[model samples]
Target chain A: MRALFLSLAATTILAGIAQAEPAIMPLDRATILAGSPFDFKIELDQVHAAADVAVTVNGQPYASVFGKPAEFVAEEKGKDGKVLGSALIARGLSIAKPGDYTVAVTAGTETKSVTWTVYGTPAVPTAKNVIFLLGDGLSVAHRTAARIMSKGMHDGKADGRLAMDDLDHMAFIGTSSTHSIATDSANTMSAYMTGHKSRVNALGVYADRTPSSLDDPKVETIAEALRRTTKKSVGIVSTAEIEDATPAAVVSHTRKRADKAEIVGMIYDVKPEVVLGGGSAYFLKSGIPGSKRKDDKDYISLFRDAGYTVATTATELKAADGSNSGKILGLFHTGNMDTKLDRSFLKTGTVDKFPDQPGLVDMTQTALDQLSKNPDGFFLMVEGASIDKMSHPMDWDRAVIETIEFDQAVGVAKDFARTHPDTLIVVAGDHTHGVSLIGTIDDDKPGTEMRDKVGVYDDAGYPNYTDADHDGYPDKIDVSRRLAIFSSNFPDYYETFRPKMDGPFEPAVKTETGDYVANEAYKDVPGAVLRVGNLPKSADTAVHAVDDVVLQATGPGSDEFKGYMEQSDVYRVLADAFALGAAQK
Target chain B: MPFALRRRQFLAALPALASLPRMARAEAPELTFDQLYGGYSALGLTFSDKVKLLDGQSVRIRGFMAPPLKAEAQFFVLTRVPMALCPFCSTDADWPDNIVVVYLEHRQTFVQPNRTIEVTGRLEHGSWVDPDTGFVSQLRLRDASFGLV
Candidate 1:
């Protein structure tokens, strides 16, 4: 019997050798919400007439199962105007049943098949609201450093705990992209928001072969799912541009996260109750002095006309909190907001230019205050963006401070959860940096070189960071002995074993040959040393790590997140908590 | 004899006196990155009085030359500090607000980003888009010539 079956499979393979298998969107083994809408697409290796192409779902006609016919293109053109292949596309397709579906396509001698699991939530919701707090590039090192810096360590024990440290349930999340082991903020956050894994730099969609960023195969974002099945308000808050990857993943569906200008339009389309962060340049008209848009669209006025209270400063943000409109759009900087170290302490970086920019805590609180007004509950995402931004430059001091700020924001969410016990709060990182907090750097160590001052094991003493004012941040970062952190990978750079007092670190600069070289600015420092890069010369800074991110949650349905899970699986817990599959409205 | 000698001296001095105005014209006023903007806000940026006064006039500024779009391109961006991230190389990076597009008088070899350069050119301000690369700039220097400072 086994020999006969092998022979049958060999005959089937031999009969279809004329062409390669076609490509299918949502790939294989995708888990989708039962009622969530998504795009269905297939790309054939060879062009086939509509008559020759056949599609079926569970051995039935595709149109009958899908309740609609897919549009067929005889020839799909590539970027260079060359005919690549034939294609079939169906937008906004959804399944209402909970089961396994096998979709098969056959065109001439080429065949491809994919299976998807359609899942459904309980008829009743488990959580009234959800607060997702994401610290971009938040790794174990950042958490350890923030704890040691904010709360002093004594006898090898933490004197205090971070707000995220008290979460009831936790999971180790795999953050790899669909195409590679390494990932970026866009792909990881998109996976959590859309329940679908995508390529790097992609959000709410599968990266297709097409050159157009907007035409990718779409997946429904959490914001859209709420808009479809419930009357819940959605809020997005971040220190980076609101149109940035993590926030944009909440409502955008672009193949490229760098499509910021287009992302603004997408955010406007969803019209979240509260949108706060930087990147106002993309919202302004091209005629505006600081505008980055190439088109004439003015999203600031568009959002204002949509009944949003626009605030440009922290003072205005506070005043706008009392706005009867219920919608707030706070844009404090023309670009990314300054780091917490620059905003509240050092007064470096762009702090002089955008001095009144609010921190992540303020934005998160404002979003909560406004969003909680909804009777149907709400979904608010607060991001500590500069944690990742500073991590990229290998500026450990600033990144740790940013993590502290993110933890404070988590505290605010915990405070909200106290009054609204039905609210579920999730604290996670989209991805991680290749950073580690090894030991301490003692200025008093007897050494001619900075590397000699590094302490490890027994010699690694505690950092002298103090929270004199008890604000959960060290009063001074440039202590005599400080936490010694390092990245596993970096470009050629001068390693200055001290805090960057002047501003954020700019370790490397590009040369004429498109290679990165150590910046000579730090060469004059007392004990600076040039460290040859472990990465390629093309890398300007340290890259993201492929390590799994830690996700913690509290409140109803939090038990779903335990042990090990995929980043995309986190969305399932969120959906089940909200009963997104069952229409609540 | 003394009168003839004095007249010869005056004749020689006439050439030097005639060149004084030309020398004054060649001495362009200098500008700094801090002086380019008077006010900055989320709404927009305002050109400083000095920047407004130097418009259409020859000016000199000191800044780091960013990598050009192309190896032999005629223009490049001038930044107040050496750019740690290449916006041209990575789509996620963006140019700072204080960048000035420099259109060189003649294409010159790009310099290392860490080295500051003194550029002399006619100052221009207002929103203008480069037709070749579609790069939009609010401030620019035309016919620029630069040398390491």
Candidate 2:
């Protein structure tokens, strides 16, 4: 029987050989849902006539299956005045059944073959009203610190609980990009939102070799899919500019995340029902005092023209709520919103100029009120962007407060979910950072030097922050005892064992030689110590960590998240929830 | 060097004070970030009278150093507040329009964000692309120098 089976397989391999070039879309070994639309392409290393290159799909001519002719482009440009190769491209194709698709393509001497696994979703829907929250780069250290600071630690146990402590489902998400083990916000969130691994800084498309960012072969995004299949409203809210990596991933498709002005246009193109966050600067016209655009593409007016209620202040945001405007475009700050530290306490950053900005909790509430109106439910993404922003500077206090603010937003989501059981809440971090809070810095138990105040292990004691008003945040950050947080990686910096009462911390400064050195402003702060850096001199702040990020969720599909999973898998669950692949007339 | 919000608020709120001509009152309506532009949009921005009238003349601006482009360059960007996370430092970094480029009279070392410095230079307006770096600046201070307050 074995000999007979071997003979049959050998015959099959022999019959598979053809004068054709192998074509792959939902490219080789891709796990596609029964009917997810993806572009199919095949490349020939050398310039070959279209008739000379033969293609077959599942042992038949590609024409017999796809029923369309593929456009052929020969002698694609190479750098330095030469042609790279020839290729074939076909957009908007999909296989409707669950099975292995073996694609074979052959040119004279060169040959290529690939396979893709097309899968189907369960017949029943799993979750509704998905609320996906991304804490840009939340890590274990940040979680531990938030628990200790907000809930307090007793002996070895946390005295209370974080908003995520009781989440019924959890997962350790691997955020590595398609090209490298390390990742950034764009590709990581792109994976979560599109179920396709992309190169760093690239979103909703493969990182093709071509120089043009928009010319890359594209994949359908969840935002596009949701729009195509459901009447459900989509909302994106973040402390970072809505055009920033994480939020933009929800609806953008560019190889570069820095194309914010274009991303704003893309967001306008999609017109997510409710949009709130900073980066009003990107929305403003080119000649406007605060606009960051190079052209006269006034997005605020465009959104308004499209019937979005525009608001620039917390008071205005609430007013827009009463507007029954149906769509809201809230531009809180001209840039990234100030972290909670600067927003509530220091009154630094852009908070002074853009005062009356709403907190994450407020933004979430406004979004829920507006989105819940539709009977079909909604999809919203909230980001505590400053968690990653402040953590990069090793400003743990600010990051923690931002996390607490994020938790408050989560609390609001959870409360909404309780009242509306149909809602699914997913709280996660896009990546992690290399920061930790080991113990405490006690000025009361210190010598003249700064390091002497560091109390690790047994010597570490409770922090002496005062929250007289009972708000989650401590009353004053400059307490005698405080969290001894530090970043594992850094550029040259001064370690000042105290809160930057004036503003957020500035750890490093550049020297005349153009290398980062410890910023000297804090050098005279009593016991400030200069600590040499470990990262490259070009690094102005600490960087994101490659470690797995912890994710927690609740609702029907939330159970699919367990142990460890790739960021891309998150999208599959989402597709199943919205029945994105279910045939639509 | 205390941060006086009241002073900044006073200067930013009342533009009527700006009517105090240089020849009349000892002080002028102190133009601020709030006064530089009145609206936000995608097409373009409108320059406040303070910035428009002060154009081509010497004026003072405060901001922190954007981590410099290089050590030998004669210019660097001066942004509102510290460039806590400088986007221009990286090739992928985005610049805010509110930025005021300072072309120094002489080369000087870049300072960290924590230090707030006062700069004095000729305020020039309109979009002008830099020949050296191709950096487009709508507002610039030619022949400028700064002092740590």
Candidate 3:
């Protein structure tokens, strides 16, 4: 019996040893853009002397192929003060040629190999400017609902079209991260901004197994690439904080997106010509009342000293537009700006405090106006961020209204594209949500319970949302007959089956024991029922779906965005559009 | 002679007892969350005149308590609304702009987040960093005590 136990333990130990192979960055099947710089790294399972480690590219010594020797670390320590492994890191490595290159590593008893495809673009540029508009967590259901609510559907399909509906070129983008099928805004946008697929919550860098959030394998962001190769202007506009994940992906390099204070420094490092959004909190000194920074750095004064025209309100933004400085930094709120529903109609949120926050359209138009002054052209990215922010809380009314506002920004881009035919317009979502527009909820046909009022199949008749002013948005969200939008997953919460009129919905709240329980504030609402959660208690609200995001584009070089492609592949198209490989400088 | 002496001692204690009611009537000045700030802008927020006047004085404010950083903590954040997201649990979540950090005089048991509480402490304004936790707060209540309202 003792011998049998000994053999069992031996089997387990052998399995552990077999699994401890060396890990490689720029993981297998990675696509690299020629001349774009990236950090190369290798993490070995065990410590080894410098002479014991062997690395080669395409059967040649790695140092000869990369044109430099990598820094060797004897041991890498983890957060718990344990020695993880030995590592080799080569920073700012680039391959100027385009071909299939295989990297093989061997140390002691472990061996690992990865192949990368390096591709190059044509010598001449296809587009002089690129306008990338992203709607966070945009899905087919959002587009359908936005069209139905804003354009008015009849009999089946008798409505106007969204600005995105007219884009001639289209693609289905797979948004999975390198580490998991699920994704977040940071890595997904980073995949578009940098031609590399990184782990979730990471931006412009691969998520290396390290304790430090900043010491990951860095990839060159699009902003840095433009700075490296061209004299074009760059602009980033969003409804979220300027340091939020989506906009921060434009120039940031970190393994964690929550490093807002550090991300502000990165934004300062890149210094995109036009940056308009919220999140002035990080830019302020720690002594300020609304500041979120933990240090004494005041970025507002720094930007002003750098010749930027700082604007804090819409009136100031308008006045700054008339300035000849050609550099504008507009901060509309301390945190994320108020959604359109609150800012324009409801006036329920923090809008009472931040009354003059600019909308997405206003920021996009201002960005274009400023960026166009550069005769060399520009690259502008506009994001409608609240679509995902409100969707997580299951606030369907605010999410759809944000979509309409996003579409108006798309219209602004399309108008710019009409005159500047050399501009390429790409509209996409970083990821998707499981929410869908099933049918309608009719108060007139309602019974006692709210679920009984739900109309599905043929019983789902048209809603009675009216746009009296001919504006895109419906006049009232609390109509008797309204659209029924529901998420596929949620935490334990009360389903009211009505538009949240007071403010954004708070589905669940954390208890003292760290479990999420249904908020009792909505329990007294008539016909509200407690629905058991399908998601884990750890989830506060709905989560991002793993489904593919639909991408639409038009203008020159947009034809390259057809068919199904990986999220990282989208950057290659952008790179190809600008001829970044040819080095215009 | 003993009864006469006891009567005189009781008369002396009556003056000390009479000031108790007057002390109770002079409660700390009540401050609301809405009155904490004078103006809000992207640049920063300005302290209201009332806040400036009440600085370094005992004041009471009613607000919801955010979940503490730990089970037993020396301090907790007081927010105008019950926080839906746990900034400690999720890296992406952030605290609201109107939060006030409360440093307790003694460790007290936390209550439900949805329950409102009135905290009485010396209202202090200006940025101060906690030595132990390194938490930076623009406004704080020092040596505070709270009870559910």
TM-score of chain B of each: 0.82, 0.75, 0.81
lDDT of 2 by residue, A1-585 (tens): 999999999989988985444334445666666666777767666788888888888989987776687788876675575775678887777678888878888877878878877767766556669999888888888887777777666678877787777789999999998778989999999988888888889877777655678766777777787787678899999999889989999998888988888899889988999998988878876655566777888888888899998888889999998888789999888778888888888898666567688999999999999999988888999999999988888888889889988988998899999988878889999999988888999988848888888999989978776567866677887788888988889888888888777777778765435566676777888888888989988788898889999999998688888998999888887877767777432
Candidate 1 local lDDT, A1-585, one digit each (tens):
999999999999888774567999888989999989999999988889999999999999999999999999889989998887999999999999999999999999889999999999999999999999999999999999999999889899999999999999999999999899999999999999999999999999998887899999999999999999999999999999889999999999999889999999999999999999999999999978899999999999999999999999999999999887899999999999999999889999989888899999999999999999999999999999999999999999999999999999999999999999999999999999999999999999998888889999989979888787899999899998999999999999999998998999999999878899999999998899999999999999999999999999999999999999999999999999999999988
Least lDDT summed over 10 consecutive residues: which range in candidate 3 chain B?
Answer: B16-25
Model 3 quality (TM-score): 0.95
The Cα error of candidate 2 at residue A15, in Å, is 32
Q: Report how far off residue A581 is in candidate 1 (Å).
A: 0.2
- Candidate 3 ranges beyond 4 A from true positions: A1-14, B1-26
Across B1-149, the per-residue lDDT of candidate 1 in tens digits comes to 69889656544544433333444335999999999999889988889999999999988899998888887676899999999999998867999999999997665667789989878789999999999899999999998777656
The local lDDT score (0 to 100) that residue B78 gets in candidate 3 is 94
DockQ-derived CAPRI band for the predicted complex in model 1: medium
For each of the candidates, what fraction of the native contacts does it recover?
0.75, 0.24, 0.77
